[model samples]
Every structure is written in structure tokens, then in C-alpha cells.
Target: MGEFAKRHQSPWPIIVCFALNFSKVVALLSPIDFLFYLFAGFTLAAGVGVITARNPVYSVFFLIAAFLNAAALFLLAGAEFLAFILIIVYLGAVAVLFLFVVMMLDINLATVRAGFVRYLPIAAVVGGIFAAQLIIMLLIWQQSETPPTLNALGNSPMNQPNNVYALGRVLYTDYFVAFQTAGIILLIAMIGAIVLTLRPRAGIKTQVISQQVSRKSSQSVRLVDLKLGQTHPTTAATAPTEPQEGSA
Candidate 1:
């Protein structure tokens, strides 16, 4: 037995073979499952790339790739409505916005990373706490008696009229208050973001709405009476000239 154990020290090779064979079998059994795994792999890889990339633009691209993969996963999971919304709202709008912002910003990587070491401990602690909470929640969910259902109408998701209808019913009926609260929170966040990034710079011309609204026609327009053939000289042209020493 000792000799046999020495000959095969680890079962990793067998485990790897089994895992590959299992995945192949699942892929063959259900194409959707295969697509789900493919998208999941893409999402995971892109998510890692987002954090690891040196260039902010590359990071934003990776994040958009991750969002696209996530949308694919959502589609494979039969949440077509959510998949489309995720693609449209996140990848189409939010990711593009992030990309534009990253491209436009004059980011100094060295300056941004200067305090990385100082904040590393706190960031690590927060990340660990978040990971732990996710693990605990997942474990609790796995052990729960009720199988996960997307339906909020007391019917199984399979029996729902449609994905959009089901989601709307849930959002408006069971989670209405929560939905409104989330909207309000999002609105506040949007306002806060606008306020934080907005700065008044010298020499930048901006329209003052109050000044515009309060202005009279006389301030903007001057009716000048001139002779038929005479041209009106501008202030610069009509200004009294300082005579040079050599001139009259």
C-alpha cells in the first residue's frame, strides 16, 4: 500500500481528468450550460483584467467585457429581459460613460498609486469582510429548504407569463418600497456625483441663467441713429490716439 501510495503521490491528475470529463458531459447534455460556463469564464477573466490592467482605458474595456459576459450569462439563465437591460443600461450607457471619463481624465498613475500602501490594509480588511459575508450568505442560501425562485407572484418562474412581466410584478408588488428607495438613493448619488465633479474654473465661460432671464432688451441691443452713407466706427477705432513724438 505504501509503495502504491508513493507511486501515485497525488490525486490531482485524476481530479483534473474527472473535472474535464464532467464539463464535457455537461456541455454535451446542455448547450446552455456550456454557454453559461463560457460566459462565466469570460466574465471572471475580464473582471480580473479590469483590476490588474496598468492602463485605465484598458481597465474600462475589461470592465465592459465583463459586463457583456455577465449579460450573456443572464441570457443563458433565461432572464432575457434582464440580460438586455444589463447590456443596454450597463454596457451601452454606464460602461461607455466610464470609458469616456477615463479617456478624458488626465490621470497620473504614480500620484493615484502613491497612497496604495497606506490604504492597502483597510482595503484588504474591507474586501475580506465583503468576501466573508458573501460566503456566509451563499452557504445559508444553499442550506435553505426553499429552492431559489425568481417569481414574486406566488408561482414558479417557469409558470410566469414572461420574464418582464414577472419582474415588474415583483418590483411593483412585493418590493415597491424597496424599489422606490433604491431610485431615490440613485438620484441622490447622481446629484452628489454632479456636485463633486463640478468646479468653477477661471476663464471658462458659462451662462448665468438668472442674469440671462433678468436682462432687458436695452442692455443687449442699442439703436444707433446714423447718417445714410456714414459707417459707425467701433470703440477701438474711435478712441483718442496718443500722438508719437515724431508725429503731429
Candidate 2:
């Protein structure tokens, strides 16, 4: 019975076949295409790890890895601006924020894992729909005709030695208002976040700008007339009380 079960259920042969097929498929891709697939695969795997990791810190690390892999993929696609933005913005700031939040929150891992497992089916369905949409989009993009190498402003990308310079010229020249508007929106969001999270504690003292600015010398200072030898009333030593009888 053991032999029969092992022969029927052992997956080694199937795994070997799949591996061979995958190797054959990989061998057909050019070097650049291989690197693209490599980075893309890492990005996908890291994204999965971010969500599936039990430890929140681990999830953040995985998220950082995903960002790095995605940045590499962007670089391979000649999107240097986007790649640097991913690295500088997401990896530098957002990932650090996620890590700090995870560390400081002191989350209950058991409860989090339980909740994740409970909602896993729903999450899986949503993830499947998103994956399907992404696949369809990718297929359509692959089939679509490539546009001319010229940019929106009638400038050839090849003429610009630096992608950043080209992107900046177009952004500042044509889309300056929109860019400033985005900055304004981001500023508002930052202010809103600060307002939402800021709480006043009963015993904590905070600097009041209005009160400080409005204060006059008279409000903060007291004029006192005194003899040359006399100190301020609050600073002068009190006369020692006569020792209470038998108190010592």
C-alpha cells in the first residue's frame, strides 16, 4: 500500500518536467529579456512575501525588496526618472515609514495572523481579479503599436543625453502648473495627516506661538522697588520660625 501511494502521489517527476520546460523557455530569451524577467519575478515574489509574511517587520523588508526590484525593472525599461523616484522616494521614505510604524506599533502578531487567515478567501478573490486585469493590460500593451521615439514636445529622447534633464524640461515647461498643484495637494495631505494624529495630553506643555507673540513686557515682568540690601520678595529668605517647644 505504501509503495502504491508513493508511486501515485510523488510529484518529483512532474516537478522535473516543469523545470526542464522552464529552462527551455528561459534559454530562448535574450540577455536583456532574461534580466527583465529576473527582476520582474523577484518583484512579484517580494510583493507576495510582503503580504504573506507573518512578521510585520519582515513584511516591510519584503516591501522594500519589491520596490528595489521594481526600480531595477524600470531602469531596464529606460525609465530612469521613474526608477530613481522609486528608489529615492519609496525605498528611502515610504519603506522607512512602514518599518518605523511596524516597530513602534507593537502589533499583536497572533491576532493579525488570525485576521489575515479569516479574510484570506476574500483577499484571494480580489487579488485574482487584479492579477487578471494586469495580465490583460500587459497583453494589450505587448500587442499595441509602438509610438515614435519623439516625446510629447516634439523632442527626440535620443537627442537628450540625460533622461532626467529631458523629463524636467518637459515637466517644467508644459506641466508646471499641474506639478505645482500636485505639490499643493501633497502638502495638504501632510497637514491633514499631522492634524489627524496630533493629540493634546493633559500634562504636556506645548509652545503657544500666539500667546508668545502677543505678550508684553508688563505681562511677563513685575516692577519692584526695594532697598539696596533687600532681595526680591519671592527670593528673600523667610525668618526662621521659633523652634516649637519640645518639637526636636
Number of the top candidate by lDDT? 2
Error of 2 at 43 (Å): 1.8
* Tens-digit lDDT track of model 1 for 1-248: 11222344554664475487975655453455455557877999999999889899999999989998998877666678888999999988998999889999978778878999999999999999999999899678747553223433453552345878877766786678999999999999999999999988889888899988997755555555678888666423543333223222
Which pairs clash (backbone N, Cα, C closer than 3 Å) in model 1? none
Count clashing residue pairs per candidate.
0, 0
Question: What's the C-alpha lDDT at position 81 in model 2?
Answer: 82
RMSD of 2: 12.3
Structural similarity to truth (TM-score) of each candidate: 0.68, 0.62
How high is the lDDT of residue 125 in model 1? 100
Name the TM-score of candidate 2.
0.62
Go through the candidates in order and give each one's C-alpha lDDT.
0.73, 0.74
